[model samples]
Target: MEEVSLGTGNWDRLTGPVREMFVAHARTWLDEQSDPSWALLDLDRLSACTMPVLLSRGSTSPSWFSMVLERLAAALPRAQRKLFEGLGPIPHVTHPQQYTAVLTEFTRPAEAGEPAPGR
Candidate 1:
């Protein structure tokens, strides 16, 4: 199987255990790509979703991933986009505190009976 690591940013920053886990799961990750259903993006169905959507990505992620996010953000009615700077594809695993902060900030307004930012 091909070597698998985070798509961008500092892979070295990932803990050894985390890196090992990723390495061990590389085959499964690659196998997922072979499923045709994984490639589908039904924008019409997505546009019909009325719930709040938080679309996040690492600033250092591959450009194609950014493009996909941009497309989804445009299509989704209530999408709020966030960029986590200096991180890679799996920011939540690499920087849990930062990820939690972003998620909390996104949900705070809703929890307070206020409209989320994009709404």
Candidate 2:
């Protein structure tokens, strides 16, 4: 298996020890996985959320994941979608700064008594 995240970004900036640590963690996480109950997902439960939601996906992610994201975004009452072009499955790991900036912008509090943006 690859020792690093796919696509370009600051993943190259990781030190040898840090990279090894991530690899170890990835191994542990992978070793602990069981078959997911994808069919049991409750799409209707998504409608219960009152907070603003931001749904994102990398352009290169698998079709099934993207389809799920599209459905979840559509089900939510207040949700915004963002597509990260030229990234891989884990955009946050590959593009931390950009991800953090977008997350901060989306989650920032609204001005006094004013409606939040992107709702």
Candidate 3:
């Protein structure tokens, strides 16, 4: 549990403003009722958002933002969604340990300042 909490905090810190974007995009998703599957995220915006700061040239396109947004639209509780954002994404987790490891990494035990137990 400590590991999860600390990991989440670390992810949040690393991602910067990504949480806000995820919330905004998610809220935008919730109020609108539509077929979730076909909902294509704005890939262009996502590309820009994931782009590194130094390499950045123009504003991130909505498509680029959609990459993460699309992953989040499971109607999951906001807390869970925020949790998901902190961890980013995993390409593959074949077993329980792997999955748990990913989730455990992001969520801190207490608040941001407190330290978590070592992994």
Candidate 4:
């Protein structure tokens, strides 16, 4: 948990329920470590998806996460990517208002029959 806090840099900012959720799912997180399926990426299938996709990551997140998001954006036909500057892995927990605003902006275009941001 300490490692997670250090890695995310906002674990302590999470609400009690949110923190509890992570704690409750600790076993699932551990199990995912050895899950081979987790490593699989069916880009073809992803590309076939027609729905709008929002790919987000915090600026402070590890570079690998940005790489993964870039790959997804390339694979998805209508993918929009957003970087939350000054935040870490769990941006929603650390900065809910900003996260919510981002989400709202992303959906607003869709609601008005327009393309998502960055599309």
Candidate 5:
């Protein structure tokens, strides 16, 4: 985990305590990993939800993550996606104010007939 973190530029950006915490949590998750039951996820049932969904992703995340995000957006009825330019995998940790601003703006009620941001 340490080597991967350093290789991915996360070690340089993260504080010592934060890195340690992340490593500990990652180890725990790895230890807890098991075969996930794919049958539990009913995509047809999920697609029935009509509420607006906001899907945000950092620009520097793994390519596969972006593909998953695309798939999730397509599966949902009213999903809006926003790619945070120049941000790393965890944008809220790296750019808290910008992340908060985007979230706040997106959650605000839109004016009549006006499309929401990122729509």
Candidate 6:
């Protein structure tokens, strides 16, 4: 799964719907967060693309995808925050603790994860 986010500049408004998903990963990512401005830069770095499918049995669930989903869930408002919980841990790539670790990192982890403000 690919992820995207827009910032304080109406990226969400600019988004359009493609097939299967919205055209604006940036908008979707940002709106999911409490502070859209912080995630603004992610918009530039992220884009729609064909990602390689990892074939490891451990890759079945896909750690990379889980990472994106977790962050998306945490970015959303509390009422809508259940998105993160729904992704479920990646079969072999992520541990239960990783769910929190990944989500918190997406918002603002001390180290090892993308912090808010897109740094």
Highest TM-score scorer: 4
C-alpha lDDT score of every prediction, in listed order: 0.75, 0.70, 0.36, 0.77, 0.68, 0.36
Worst 10 residues of 1 by lDDT: 1-10
TM-score, cand. 6: 0.19
Q: Cα miss at 59, model 1 (Å)?
A: 1.3
Better candidate by lDDT, 2 or 5: 2
- Per residue, candidate 6 scores C-alpha lDDT tens digits across 1-119 of 32222112222333244322545364664566556454343522233322211211122333544465455444433212223332322322224454455445445634655344334
lDDT of 3 by residue, 1-119 (tens): 11322232333343446555555676555545355655555544544442112111111223333444545443222213222332323212112354455456544454757454332
My TM-score estimates for the predictions, one after another, are 0.75, 0.65, 0.22, 0.78, 0.71, 0.19
Error of 5 at 106 (Å): 0.5
Better of 3 and 4 by lDDT: 4
Model 3 spans with C-alpha error above 4 angstroms = 1-37, 40-93, 110-119
RMSD of each: 3.8, 4.1, 17.0, 3.4, 4.2, 16.6
- Decide which is better by lDDT, 2 or 4: 4
Query: In model 2, which range of ten residues has the least summed lDDT?
Result: 1-10
lDDT of 5 by residue, 1-119 (tens): 32332225655677788777886798665654443542244567768878788888777676645766777787889888888876665766667788899889887768886666545
Clashes of each: 0, 0, 24, 0, 0, 5
Instruction: Give the higher-lDDT candidate: 4 or 6.
Output: 4
Estimate the overall C-alpha local distance difference test score of candidate 2. Answer: 0.70
